[model samples]
Target: MPRPICSQCQFLIQQCLCDHLSVVKSDIELVIMQHPSEVGHAKNSVRLLPHLLDKVRIVVGETEQDFAQLKAELEAESRPIYLLYPSEQSVEASQVKHSQQGILIVLDGTWRKALKLLKFNPWLLSFQSLHFSPQAPSRYRIRKASRIDSLSSLEAAAFGLQALQPQMDIKPILSAFDAMIEQQLVHMPEHVQARY
Candidate 1:
């Protein structure tokens, strides 16, 4: 039988991360467009995002039709909507003007899947794209990244939010991610853990 999972934390009963979560309130609005496959993936970092941000919307899908309503909602919003993807046209996150709180949309998926999501949802291209150079390497050790500089969605959001609002504490924003890594590391074999 499958191990019982916590409905809230989505981890095995004993490994639930709900208790490890730390909340950070940000004035900016965040919208995470997650591919369907990432919803329950063990190493998925987007899981820690809602616990980190005070205001976050997690929309799961990878198609234009799936995101139609969200697109409409974004279109109607008066606040500046920015896409957190590094397109040829994207500007550095630090270059973003920080006058007022605005909606920031992040794609939560592997690079290939993120590209697929972008292709499927072309409307996303219309928004101003923002990219950031990772200040540090990824703490996401369990998964292998195709690129060296890639940060997990949680890490990306944390850094992105930091760029948008320099006053935000980086520690609390990343506490759950660190905790999740610790939890996963505990389950790994010592020999395997040593490799990471």
Candidate 2:
């Protein structure tokens, strides 16, 4: 039988992250487009983001049709919509004009899966794209990234939000992320944990 899952964090009851969650409200909206394959991945930080932040929308799918409601909402809103993908055309997040309120769309998946998501959702091409230069390496200890610049969904969101809203306090969200990583570290083998 499947282990009992926490209704709040959706993590196994024994590994529940509910207690570590820190709720933060933001002026800028976040839309996380997660690939369906990441749904059950234990190290997927995207799963923890919504619980910690206000005004976050999590959409699971790889196709335009799957995000119909989100697309409609973006269209209806007067604020600009920006995709947080590091494409050649993307401008650095720090350089984005702060004059307008906007929505930031982040694709939560591996590099290949993220590319697939972009391929399937062509409409996202119309939006302005933004990228960020990480001052430090990703703090995602549980998963191995092929590239040093790669960041987990939560880290990307935190950095993106910090850049978009300089006044926003991201400490709570980052603290919760660290707590989750610490929890996952307990389940890792000694050799694996040593690398972190």
Candidate 3:
């Protein structure tokens, strides 16, 4: 039988994270493009982003139709759209001034899947791209990353939001992220858990 899920947080009852969450209103809107494969993933941080922020829209898929809808939304809004993708052309997140107003699109998926999403959506190439030099190691302990600089979707969003809006408090999001990591660690074999 499936485990009982928490209606509020949507996590299994034993792994519910409602108490750890803190909701905050954001000046910048977040448009998360999630790969279908990430849906219902136990450790998917994208699931927590909408819960933490007041303005978040999740679009799932890489089809032309999906891109069309995203494009329409972008056209409807006057805000400049920025893609949070790391590339040679991407500017440091900190460089994005607070004066800038617009949407931030985050691609949520494995590196390969993220690349596929970009390739499938040619229009996304027009958006400004941003990246961050992580000040600390990623808190995503459950998943092994090919590169040390890699961060989970939530971490990227938190860092990006802080960079764009220096005054915005992101402690709650980070606190909840840490709580999720700690909960995951408890489920691992004691021998496999990292020692601090």
Instruction: State which candidate has the highest lDDT.
Output: 2
Which ranges in model 1 have alpha carbons more than 4 Å from their true place?
Answer: 190-195
- Please give each candidate's TM-score: 0.93, 0.92, 0.92
List all candidate RMSDs to the true structure: 1.6, 1.7, 1.9
Error of 2 at 80 (Å): 1.2
lDDT of each: 0.87, 0.88, 0.85
Residue 38, model 2: Cα distance from true site in angstroms: 0.6
Mark the 10 consecutive residues where model 1 has the least summed lDDT. 170-179
Q: Write down the TM-score for model 2.
A: 0.92
**What tens digits encode model 2's per-residue C-alpha lDDT throughout 1-196?**
9879888888888778888887898878899999999987888898888888888989998888999888888888889888999989999888887677789999999999999999998889999999989999988877899999989999999899888888889888888898888887987889989987
Candidate 2 Cα errors over 4 Å, as ranges: 189-196
Give residue 71's lDDT in candidate 2 (0 to 100): 84
Evaluation by lDDT, superior candidate among 2 and 3: 2
Q: Least accurate stretch of 10 residues (summed lDDT) in model 2?
A: 93-102
Residue 8 Cα positional deviation in candidate 3, in Å, after optimal superposition: 0.6
Model 3, 74-133: lDDT tens per residue? 868777788999999999877877566678989999888899999988778788899988
Q: For residues 1-196, what per-residue lDDT tens digits would candidate 1 score against the true structure?
A: 9999989877788678888777888867889999999998988888777777788999999899999999999999988888999978999988888677898899999999999999999999989999999867898888889999988998888888888888888697677788888888898889989978
lDDT of 1 at 20: 76
